[model samples]
Target: MLDINNALEDKLLGFIGAGNMAEAMIRGIIRNQVVQPDQIIASDISVERKEHLSSAFDIRIATDNHSLIDQSSVIFLAVKPQAVPAVLKDISANTGAEKLLISIAAGVPVKTLAAGLPKGPRIVRTMPNTPATVMEGAMAIASDSPARPEDLETVETLFRPIGRTVRIEEKLIDAVTGLSGSGPAYVFMILEALADGGVKMGLPRDVAETLAAQTLMGSAKLFLETRTNPGQLKCMVTSPGGTTISGIHELEKGGLRASLMNAVEAATIRSIELGKA
Candidate 1:
């Protein structure tokens, strides 16, 4: 793990694309009080996007790629996978040793991003989920060959405010994409199902949703605070011939565990496919 003690205040952080993920990160950084808005800048091809980001985040907006690259030491490649090549080409002329690049573009490898530049910027590829919008996300970070120890630390420092972060080997970034990247949707499905079960048991719609959400939240908190493995926690809750045990039996019968594993596997394969593309 990289050091979290390093401050992100030393350099300007720029977003090359003003999109949802970019907005989530900006919201997270600002909400965590990492730096003043003036220290951040973003550029987008869309006039509407530029306006929205500038107005919502109160950060400077650059009219062109070159201008943003000129001003930033740490730049985020937050554009779509298809858009990456063009943007990389556009910024190549100005990229330099002083810059560290962080990319959140899904399925676009670090090699692909670095390929467009002659001498590439130290590159870090990241996988962050939608929960980052609320600053409660999970993220995985990986770096290219040119990246240094300090570069990894800088990447971690940039994302630490967003949510929980982990550094993984570049090869497993696809696995991270499968587990945490697509995992939020799986979690949401679980939440919805739990809520539905509550409603089936006679709770009102709103009350059922609240109870389900709180249950998951409280359980997660307990797991984190007590540093207990989930199996241990589950065993602690499950009783001899009790309702919880019955529910677990039903879940097992339905192959919930295998289904989730398969879901992650399928998603990982898809990520690999995208990377190959």
Candidate 2:
């Protein structure tokens, strides 16, 4: 393991972008006290964004990307997929084999990242979701062949404060992107639909929204705390001749379950296609 406690003490963390996902991780790290503000640095093209980050987090913000890479031991490539190639090319000369690089850009593969960097540099590719904004994300990571065990641990520690993380083969990352990366939006849509149903039943909008959100949170917590299968949990809430069962039947009749399954499948396929693109 990288010894997260030790890594944060001696290492400078760098981010190549100051966008929402990057900003969320920065906030999470500081809020959790995993890294002191001084230990983290960021660079972005926008002067306003740089100033905003500086004011918001009290961390060093560089106007140029090279300066950020030059000063840090661990660098996070948090830029969008389209921006990655140019950013990587810009930093390739500055990043040596010793530095650990973590990338959260979706649809960009580890091998692609490695090819863009100096040979033998440690690279960790991760897929993190929008829920990271709320510190409740699901993330998956995969390390390049040259990545050391400690390097992988350092990456895991960085994300731990944000949400649950898992290590998987790089090949599985696209599936992770489909299931969790885009999954939050799916859940949000469901929550909206549930709230709409509540409103249709004469419940006030605010109360219905609150109940829907809480119900989702509570059900998720139950699954986590009890470590029970979702099917079993659903059964527990459902009575043979009651409202829960009645609602479930309506959902089934509406092809909700099948639609969800197809939706996830479509997302997975689309992710693969995007990566190939």
Candidate 3:
């Protein structure tokens, strides 16, 4: 369990959107005992969403953004990128220097977020992936100049239980979005392809999928635990004149490496374009 600092313990955490990512964070925080469920509050435009989240997480549901910001200290700006400007404007009057705003809206910058509100509220921007719903996400955090070190630390503490967290420059957040934010879909595609190969070789669909998923999960665990070069690890698995070598040869011939690189690059470029829009 994470030891949430006293600064956070005494304060209420609020979520501006009761979406998947916000729910994921709420689940992790409560499951990890970072804070009591009662100390959390969420506000959403949909009454059904508010009631559902409140019931599911046993947390409070605020009637509106203004009330939520007024009652909480740490606020998660979890609304969609397109919705951020209006949300900031809606809650701006209630936001103050003492409150901390942590945003997970992809392609939205701290500068843009700050511009929508009063000048003094601290802002921390993040890019987090869908895997966060399962508590195994990769997150990149960056903060505006006004945000203090402890504010950054608070954000890290809130996220640590859900997955790995990396502090990065705001400029690189778009790259992080392409790599990790959109990475789960790429990995899912690869997993599906691997399972399809097994099914083509006569394995049952369910068994093949399970094996493929376990193989991917185990490989990731091994890589993380050993911290060995991936190339070295690949060499370890590919013995002279072995089946693994044959498979690797086919992958290389198929330009698998180049395809993945191009995917990331393309996604990164798109992210930049979206931010501009």
Query: For residues 1-277, what per-residue lDDT tens digits would candidate 2 score against the true structure?
Result: 4566576456679999999888888888888877889888999988888888889999998768888887888888988888989898889897888778888887788777778886556888888886766778899988543588887788788888889999998888888887898898889999999999999999999999999999999999998999999999999989889889998889999999898888878888887776566
lDDT of each: 0.85, 0.84, 0.87
**How many angstroms is residue 227 displaced in model 3 relative to the true structure, after the best TM-score fit?**
1.0
Scored by lDDT, model 3 comes in at: 0.87
- RMSD of candidate 2 to true structure, Å: 1.8
| Candidate 3: tens digits of C-alpha lDDT, residues 5-25 | 465556689999999889888
Residue 216 CA error for candidate 2 (Å)? 0.4
User: Which residue runs of candidate 3 sit more than 4 Å off their true CA positions?
Assistant: 1-5, 143-145
List the candidate numbers ranked by lDDT, top first. Answer: 3, 1, 2
Which number leads on lDDT?
A: 3
What is the lDDT for 97 in model 1? 71
Model 3 shows how many backbone clashes? 0
lDDT per residue for candidate 1 within 33-53, as digits (tens), equals 776788889999998998998
- In model 3, the clashing pairs are none
Give the 10-residue window scoring lowest on summed lDDT in candidate 3.
Answer: 1-10
Sorted by TM-score (best first), the order is: 3, 2, 1
Model 2, which residues run further than 4 Å from truth?
Answer: 1-5, 8-11, 143-145
